[model samples]
Target chain A: MSKNIIIASTSTLHGGDYLEYLLPELSVHFEHCKTILFIPFARPGGVSHDEYTVKVSSALAKINIEVKGIHEYENFSKAIKNAEGIFTGGGNTFLLVNQLYENNIMTILAEAIKDGIPYLGTSAGSNICGLTMQTTNDMPIIYPPSFETLGLIPFNLNPHYLDSDTQSKHMGETRETRINEFHSFNNIPVVGLREGSWLVVKGDTITLKGHLTARLFRQNQTPAEIESETDLSFLK
Target chain B: MSKNIIIASTSTLHGGDYLEYLLPELSVHFEHCKTILFIPFARPGGVSHDEYTVKVSSALAKINIEVKGIHEYENFSKAIKNAEGIFTGGGNTFLLVNQLYENNIMTILAEAIKDGIPYLGTSAGSNICGLTMQTTNDMPIIYPPSFETLGLIPFNLNPHYLDSDTQSKHMGETRETRINEFHSFNNIPVVGLREGSWLVVKGDTITLKGHLTARLFRQNQTPAEIESETDLSFLK
Candidate 1:
């Protein structure tokens, strides 16, 4: 079956709008596609259902894309196999991983990807694309025996990268140190995606989308900046 | 190297105070033990260094147990090998797993636990005592490339069991359902520890501490109540 997929970080339904980051490509991808299957159940933690899914579906409706939420589907395998385009909205990665692992949907998703589903991942949803879910700053507030991921993108993705606010009262590892920690163990490039930004992956090619720049972290080299046209050899 | 251990559900610093729930036998276990080590860094998310570690020492000092906070020891090997008795504080399970996996400390800790060091885990720290980090309410907020743990105590540990408060205001998965999901994949019994509670593991014996009750979620059966004197066969 033909498949194109888009997985978002946390949908703006709660905090901010990721629609602008998601919709343009999602709409363009769905433009020629016959049907779009919207996965609202990807909001795994259950907190995300009322917060984001409703907002995303309404926004996509305005853009003329017929988006269908996946939670209403009776058969999960059919929902996954029948979709011409699959868009996974993000909420909580643990919850997402838990549901996928429980329902045995991760294997199906990986198969669809290998079969060239034209997948797109953003934020938490984007996180599952990497070799492992090892770089996100989300709290392991929930646990799923394994940190298994889709392993499609073959890179560690850091979404919503923010500078340490010296004025803030939050006390935890800073973003820079956390990324450094990722580098301490992983040789793969860690992509820091700012708000409204994304990594667009086509056949054997990956390019940046939106107006935000990305910070690349690797071992033994100073972190470098990647402009829009930068070669994403890591993803390729 | 005499070893002392404190396996608590919540530390005195995390505003949960496990000492009040301390079994009288535990106090005797550490009576002759000088050089008490406080492991506050195990909890990577919620509790801060200042908030969790310093208080552990100060509280232990009140009872004449010479305490030392191990937060400054960045080296995992030295931290585990030379430690007198290691106490793991609670925060988030994902954060602890990532650090243990990234630094390769699980094997070191497993060895330490085997040497009869009094190992204590509370909430997030306690969750790390399982075979896998399967039963937790923390988000997969931080992903370590893998999900291996200390394997100190057999059976999964679920800290802080709570009922769903109508889900209209709460944002995360309910504790019961999350544990239920965990049982669907794992056949292991899950020990639900409330605040001010703990499980003291000595050799093959598992003793329940704290005034509150605990729920045990087993495979294919309804969760059963674990009374004060009930011996947990999973600890065997």
Candidate 2:
């Protein structure tokens, strides 16, 4: 249970610098690492691998850490196994999971994470840490081999989770309604991680962090708000 | 190419009754039918098959058109072939498409639509009429056998499409950004059917119906707002 991970709801907050809010925390998370492998498969706005990697590099530059895109490697599995640390940026979950499966590195990355390599994930990146990517907010731009994921956590993570706007006139399904529908067919617990909030996984303990509270959804129960500093290890 | 269909952005408007706005049109579209087969695979808010079917039945009762759930039939393919008309209710795109492929009836339904059987699709249902469900906004509650849909139209559809609220502080990916990501990998055109707007397909001519404008998105081209009654045959 030596899972050292940071599952964030978003990579960049609105009006904030890229990864600026989490730099201090990440600085400590990756203290022992020199370079971290970045998986840019989620392709934020369909950015190219190199371009997305550059974004990550720029964000991590302030922390004095180097970043490399996995797509640049000739052997992806070797890259995962040999990486000092790993950082998966967010975009479309389907595309990210598709590339992970297509390159046959899903299991390798999962093993690496389980082996206690520091990991940082935001949005779609954090989604794969759950049992499956079934709770993602991204469009299904690509079909993954399966909905299965790393299963680093027992429950599913719904990143970029937002509460229904009471004044909105939109008829589209709200985030809560969508998750309830997921519960109709699934028995897994779901953590609705709000933007700026994240889960800090250290060994067998997972503590909710940042400035906001998270919504926890379970089958046949009213969703409850979990405050910061809450230990969610019980969900495991 | 006598694809007689009504692809709606939503089954119900923000404050309108279920299918109330579309009843007159549906009355004409399903004029020759006594009973229309209803596929309730997209269970909105985790509604039961029977419960969702009842909602559709109630909505169509005014038109004197009886509605039957496809799940009630012993053979789904036979049910599709025997249907005088078909209506796929919107819920979850992934769930609906999953059931379609799982029951091995995607081809059957596609054939029925191609043969010009009167058809009605709202939201997730309308999403399946496109080249793929890559542009869907529904959470991926389940994984379908393929993202390939019925291909009833030349382009994809984004139902319940909305514009970004300028005053809102939400940082989630906007509909435009999601579609742009889809275009980065796919060259297909996408129609963002806003609430209250629908497409009336007759033969090779697809006319925008209802009172609102539908936004059309093509790769490398600026997205344009198409007024009601505009013939979108050029997209084909």
Candidate 3:
């Protein structure tokens, strides 16, 4: 079966409500499904799973879609298998990957998504769709058993990608610099997804979405700017 | 033997030459030492170990102290043991920790520093002096065998800590937010050492250095703004 996915850079854009920016796109993307199975393991601000679920639930309700937390189910793998649609909210990528591995649902969810179930991932959630979680900007608060992820896509992602502020005196590595460092150790390509940007993956076609142009970094090559609506299926 | 260490937030400040800001203090930090051993595993910007060593070598030349890379020695542990002073340059924390474990010199180097070998760590280097490298802001680039480090200090260090920019529309987690997420899973205290700030450890006493105030985050406690020269021994 062909895959259907919306991998977004962020759940909430600046000054916007949670999942607000993507609501229009998501409504169409998840039109066929009545509900979305919410994976709240990536708990932003360390919110409890139920609390994070409620936030996503209320947001998706605007489009008349009910949301259920995967944690609410008796068996996580069974939950994913039964899910008609899946939406994983953003938080710490390490925490999300660790929970998925610990619950033995990482592979199950990956298979479910590949089976053509509509899926939406934001920030940390979007990161797991990559070849590895090595390019994540989240803190390694808790170490997962492995850096592996779903591998739904051929490349990795650097979410909420910010350009360097020339005016600022801060010496922290810029998003580009960090991705360059990642290239130093791994050969996987990385997409620097800026806020309000996302990737639309429909089976064999993967296209950049939203207003911003994404930065693409490949090993031994200069990073390129990918405009909206650009097909990125060539990354593999 | 008492510990004599300088753990800094960054190697260089904006518009400053490498090690320019810290040369005065570093001169005193390594006053008794004739030659210092350099650990260039972090390799900022993916520079080679020898290339990184050359940068450090020239920088320390201003202090009239000779420098040597640890990679130059066949017996890595022995080189560390006989070193009068040690300096680990800033770069990718994961790469640094991975290299240390791979070489089996992590414990040896830790012991050497604790035995009164004057040591200096900047950025990724300073991160290893903490209880764990969990608070670092670097990309994971590579998977280290363990997040464990020198544990020379009671708490973890978040080097190059950045304050949230109220004016910017970027949705990335601020340093404080990331550290807060860390607190949810780990109890280790984390010092958010801003660029230009550092910690001076003389035996059991660890004091904040530089002109800027550092932020301290403890589990379940409100983040505090620490003043310069303030002793942080209470974190233990």
Task: Find the candidate with the highest TM-score and give its number.
Answer: 3
Cα deviation at B55, candidate 2, in Å, is 1.3
Instruction: Put down candidate 2 lDDT per residue, B17-82, tens digits, no spaces.
Output: 999999999999999999999999999998899999999999899989999999999988999999
lDDT tens per residue, model 1, A1-236: 33244434334423445466466667777676555666554454334455555666677775686666667688887887877666766655566776778888888977876676655555667878776676765434355656768876657777766556676332234566667655544577777766655766665456666675778777656877778655474552
Two-chain DockQ for model 1? 0.10
- Candidate 2, residue A218: the lDDT equals 95
Candidate 2 ranges with C-alpha deviation above 4 Å? none
Candidates arranged by TM-score, highest first: 3, 2, 1
> DockQ-based ranking, best first?
3, 2, 1
* Candidate achieving higher DockQ, 1 or 3: 3
Worst 10 residues of 3 chain B by lDDT: B165-174
Candidate 1 chain B lowest-lDDT run of ten: B165-174
DockQ of 2: 0.84
User: What is the docking quality class of candidate 1?
Assistant: incorrect
What is the Cα-based lDDT of residue B171 in candidate 1? 25
lDDT (10s digit) by residue, model 3, range A99-194: 999999999989999999999999999999998999999999998999999999999998999888778788888878888888887999999999
Question: Which is superior by DockQ, 1 or 2?
Answer: 2
Superposed by TM-score, candidate 1 places the C-alpha of residue A109 at a distance from the truth, in angstroms, of 2.0
Better of 2 and 3 by DockQ: 3
- For candidate 2, the docking band is high
Q: For candidate 1, what's the RMSD?
A: 8.7
